[model samples]
Target chain A: MTPFELIVREHGPTVLRVCRAVLTAHDAKDAWSETFLSALQAYPRLGADANIEAWLVTIAKRKAIDVIRTRARTPVPVGDVPDGASELGIPDDERGEVWALIGALPDKQRKCVAYHYLVGLPHSEVAAIVGGTTDAARRAAADGVAALRRAYATIPGGTA
Target chain B: MTNIEAPNTADLDRLHDRLVHAADEAGLLDLAYRTVDTPIGRLLLAATDRGVVRVAFETEGHDRVLGDLAARVSPRILNTPKRLDTLARELDEYFAGQRLGFDVPIDFALSRGFRRDVLGHLAVIPYGTTESYAQVAVATGNPRAVRAVGTACATNPLPIVIPCHRVVRTDGSLGGYLGGLHVKRTLLDLEAAA
Candidate 1:
C-alpha cells in the first residue's frame, strides 16, 4: 500500500467517528465526502511533519461546524430516542449499536465524546476546538461515556 | 475498564479500533472499484475492504478521486484502490437488480443538526418505493418542516446508500438530487423493474 493510503486506513475511522459525532449519519456522509474531497486537493502540500490524522480531523470538524452553521436556521427536533426494538429488521453491528447510543447523547456531550475519545484529542485540544476550557471538554466527554455505558448496559453483556 | 478518568492513549486506540470494527463487524467487507456504464455516464465506484464507499457519476480524473480517498480513508489512502473492488461488485449488483440493499459502512461525521435529521430519516426509505418530503417530515415527527426535508435530501452525500433518491415531492414529481435527477430516475426505475 502507498504511504498515503496506509495512513488513511489507520486514521480514517477516527475522522469518520469525529464527523459522525458532530453530524448525523446522513449529513456525516456529505461532510465526510466534502472533507475528503478537500483533503485530496490539499494532500500534496501537507507537510510530512504534520499529524495527518489530526489535520484531517481538524478539517472534518470545521466542515461539520459549517454544516451546523448553514443549517442552524432550522431547529428540527431530534425525534424520540430510538429503541432497539424499532430497528429489529436492520442488521446489528457495533457501528449501528454504538451509533444508536451515540445518537441518544445531547449534542455537546456527543461532540465531546467524538473529539476526545474517538478522535484522541486531549481535553485541552478538544477544549480549544470547541471553544471551552479543558475541564469542560473533559466533563462532557465523561458524561457522554457514562450515558453511553448506561444506555448499552440494558443490552445484556454490552459492557459494564 | 472502570476508573476511566481520562481517555489515555490506549483508550483512544481501543475506541478507534472498535469504531473501525463497527463497520467490519457489520459485514461490509468488499473493496473494489469498477467503471460502470450507466445511463447517466461512467460512474466512479469505490468500496472498502467490505462494501462500496463512493459511486460518483460523470466524475472523472485521478487527482480528485485520489484526494477523495485521502479524506475518507485519510492517512490510509493506499487501501482505497482495493476498496474500489468492493464498490465495483456492489454497483454491479445494484444495477443488475440482484441487490436489494447495500451493506456498506458509511462515515456520517460531517453532518450534524438539521441536515443530519433529514438524512437519517431518508435512510429508512425502503428500496423501489418513494416518499414525499412532507411525509418524511411527518414521519420524522417534524410535520411542519417539509422544506427542511427537501434541503436534507439535497445535501445527502451517500445518496444511494441513504436512498435519498426515494424522497420525492408531494405531487409525485422528482424534486432535486445532488447526484442529479437522471440518476434518481435510473435508481427508481431499477427498483421498479424488480
Candidate 2:
C-alpha cells in the first residue's frame, strides 16, 4: 500500500481545485482537509484496484456539499468578510479569481468541469459522482467551460 | 490547458502542514511516519501519540512495515514528518557522530513478553560497546535465554534506536541483525569510529 503522504502530495492540488471549483477558496480549504482526513480514516479499506483520484474527488464533492450546508445555516459577521483573501497570505491566487468564476456555474455543471477539466478524469467517472449519464456530464462540462470562457474574458488578465 | 496550475506549489506545502495539524488535533492521525536516508540505508521512522514507535531499515521494506503497523496500531497512518522531525535530526546527528544517545521516547508495543524485556536491556548497552547475546540474556536475568535474545535481536522493531545491533556472539563474532550483517557492522563501526 502507498503511504498517505504520497497521496496528498501527488493529488493535493488537484483535490484543492476540485474543492475550489465546488466551493470558494476559503471554504475549499475546509473541504480539502475533510476530504483527506476522511480518506485517511478509510484508507485501509480502500481497494488495491481503486482509482485514487476519482475516489478523492467523490469525497471532496460530498464534503463540499457539507460545507455548503453549514455555511447556509451559520450567520456571518459583516466585519469578518473574506473579500480580502489575498491579504491573509493565501498566495499567488490569481487562480482564486478563476475558481470564483468556475464556482459561479450551476452546481452540477461546475463539478463536472472541475472533475473533467481540472482533474482530467473521464466523463464516466465524473458521472459516477455527479449522478448522471456520461453524455450529460460531458455536456455540462462543455457548457461550464464555455461559460468560464465568457466570464474569464471579463477578468483583468484572463487568457480568453 | 495541459498544465493546470490551480493550487500553487507553495500553498500545497502549506496545506500539507495544515492537514497534519488538523488531523492531529482531531485525533484521527495514529501513525505519523517519514523516511530518512542514512549511512547504512534509508530508514523508515514512525511515531505514535506515546512516542517513536518504529525505526525500520530499508531492507525491512518500508511499505510492509506500514502495513504491519496499520494492522497492529490504528490504520490511520500519514507521512507527517513533523512528528519525527526531532528524531530524524537526532539520527542525522548520531550518524555524523555529534550525538551519543537518542533523546526520543520509543514505544515497544510491537514486541512483547521476553522480546520486550530483551530490548529494554539492549537499550542500555551503551554506544561503542558490544555485548554477546549470552551476556545480554544474563543481564536481563535469563542467562539460559540466549536463543531468545537472538530471536529478540532478529525481530526487534526499533533496531538502531533500541541498539539491537550491539548484541554479538559470545566468541566476539557479529551475530545476525534485522538490518542484515553489513548494516549491523556499519552501525557498530559508526559508534566505534565515533
Candidate 3:
C-alpha cells in the first residue's frame, strides 16, 4: 500500500471526527473530502518524518474553517417549516412539537450542541475547532443544552 | 415557559441515534452501519452496495458518513446496512479471536497503485506478526524504497482492517496510528491476547 493510503486508512476516523466537531454535519462531510484531497496533493512536499495524524488534522481544521467562513458570507435558506412546531418531517404530530423546540436554537448553539454531544469531542478539541478557548467551548455547550431543556419544558410532553 | 433552547448532550445523543435510525429507515443515506461500542468511543463500520466504502469513528453522525459515501462513490452509492452485518459479526469475532481474517469484499477505489501495493502487502502481515517499513520495501521489490513503504503505511485509508498497525519501524518500535496509539496498542494486545 502507498504510505499515504495507509495514513488515510489509519487516520480517516480522526479526520472525520475533527471535521464533524468543527463544521456542521452538512458541511463536515465536504470538509472531510477536501481534507484528503488536499493532503494527497500536498504529500510530496511534507517532510518524511512529519506526524501524519497531525498533518491530517491540520488539513481538516483548515478546510472546516474555510467552510465556516464561506457560509458566514451568505446564509443558506433552511428548508421550509410546515407549522410553528412541525417542519422537520416528523411522522407524528406530537413528536414534531418536541423537535421544534430543539430546532429553535440559534445556529451557533445548535452547532455547539451537535459537536459536543453527537461528535463527542472533548472541550479542548471543540474549542480548537470553534476558534475559542476550552472554557468558552464548554460554556457554550452547557448553555446550549440548558436552553434546550427549558425549551422542551414549554411543550406538553417535554421534560428537561 | 418563557424561554426555549437547544438540545442537551443527553438529548442530542438520543436524537443522534434516532436520526441515524430514521436515516436507515428512510434510505436517506447510501451507507448504513453500526458503531461498535469498543475501547474506543464507537467504531463505525459503513459500506455501500459496491463494497465497504468507509469505516469511521462514531463521532460524526449520518450526515458525515453519507457525505463521505457520496463523494467517494458519487453515483454508485447504495446504502446496504445488511451487507455490513456480516462484517460486524466478523469484526466482533476477530476481536474475540474466533476469526482469523476478513472474507468480505472491499472496494479499494479509495486507493491506487503504490498505496494499494503497500496496504495489500500490509494485509498479509499475519495477525500475530509484525513487519518493518524497510522489510515491506524489500517485499515490494525495491529495497531502497523503505521511505516509500513508510509513506504507504502513513497514507493507508483503512487502518485495522488493512492491518497497517502490524507495520513497525525497522528498529522494532511501534509506529503511528491515525486512531491514536491507545487504539493501536489495544489491537496489538488483542492479537497478543489471542
Candidate 4:
C-alpha cells in the first residue's frame, strides 16, 4: 500500500485548489484538511488502482457542500458590509474578487469549472463527480468560463 | 477558458499542519502518525485510538509497516502526529539523557501468541541492562523459545520504546536488532554512557 503521507504530499495542492474554487480561502483550507483526514482514514480501503484524483475531487465537492451548509447554519452578522465595487490588485484583492466571480456562477456550472478547470479533472470524471454526462459537463465548463470572461472583463484586472 | 492564475498557495503548507490540529479536535483522524528524525534515522510513528501502535525504522520499510497497520488495525489512519506528542517528547527526552523510562501507553494489537508474550517481557529489561535471548525465553516461561525470543526481538514493531535493543546473544555479545546491529550497538552504548 502507498504510504498515506505520500498521498498527502503529492495531491495536497490540487485538493486545496479544488476546495478554494468552491469555498472561501479559510473555509477551503478547513475543507481540504477534512478531506485529507477523511481520505487518510479511508485510504486503506481505497482500491489500489482507483483514480485518486477523481476520488479526491469527489471528497472535496462533498466537503465544499458542507462548508456552505455550515455558513447557512450560523446566524448572520448584522450589517455585514456588501462587497465594494473597486478595481483590485493582483495579490490580495484580485483573488477575492476572482473567487466572488466564480462563486457567483450557477451551481452546476460552478462545480464544472471548479472540478474541470481549476482542479483539472477530465470532462468524463468531472461529469461523474458533478452528476451528468461528459458532453454536459464540458458544455457547463465552457459556458462557465465564457460567463467568467464576460463578467470579468467588466471589472479591471478580472480577466488578468 | 479565461486564464486564472493559480493563487499563491504558500499558505496551504502552514494550513496543512494547522488543519491536523483541527481534524484531531473534530474527532476525524482515527490513526495519527508522523515521521520523526532520531539518532538512528527517520522513524515512522503511528498510533491508534488506544495508544502508540507502531514505531518503525527506515530500513524496515515505512510503507510496509503502515500497510501492516492498515490491515491489522483500523484502516482509518492519518499522519496527524498530535496524538503522539507525548511519545515524541518522551523519545526526545530519552535521547537527550533526561528520561530513564518511557511513560507512554503502547498498543500491541498487531502482535500475538509467543511474539506478544516475548515483547511484554522485553519492556521491563531496564534502561542500561542487557539480557540474553535465552534468559528472556526462560523468563517468558518457554525455555525452548530461545530462537523464538530472537525472532520476536527481530520483528519488534515498537523497538526503542519496548527496549528490544537490550536483548543480546547468550555469549554476552549483541545478537541482532530489527533496527540493525549498528543501531542496536548505538542504543546499548547510549545507555552505557548515561
Predicted structure with the largest DockQ when compared to the true one: 2
Ranking the candidates on DockQ from highest down gives 2, 4, 1, 3
**Candidate 3: where is the Cα deviation over 4 Å?**
A1-160, B1-33, B58-68, B75-80
lDDT of 4 by residue, B20-68 (tens): 6765776656678988888889989998778888999999888788777
The per-model DockQ list reads 0.10, 0.40, 0.03, 0.36
The better-scoring model by DockQ among 2 and 4 is 2
| lDDT tens digits, residue span B1-194, model 3 | 22222222443343334434444455444444555665565776766546665666554454465455545654222333455788877878888787778888776777788878888888798987888888888898888988878778766666668888888887877877667777777888888888
Best-performing candidate as measured by TM-score:
4
Q: List, residue by residue over A1-160, the lDDT tens digit for candidate 4.
A: 6655567767887887777666666677778887987786677678879988788888887887887788986412211225553212123544556666776778788889988887778899889888879999999999998888887788875553
* Angstrom error at residue B183, model 1: 2.0
- The estimated TM-scores of all candidates read 0.43, 0.80, 0.46, 0.80
Shift of residue A13 alpha carbon in model 4, Å: 3.3
Which pairs clash inside model 4? A41-B76
Instruction: Write the candidate numbers in order of decreasing TM-score.
Output: 4, 2, 3, 1
In terms of docking quality, model 1 is: incorrect
The top-ranked prediction according to lDDT is 2
- What are the per-residue Cα lDDT tens digits for candidate 2 across B127-181? 9999999899899999999999999989988888899889899898897988889
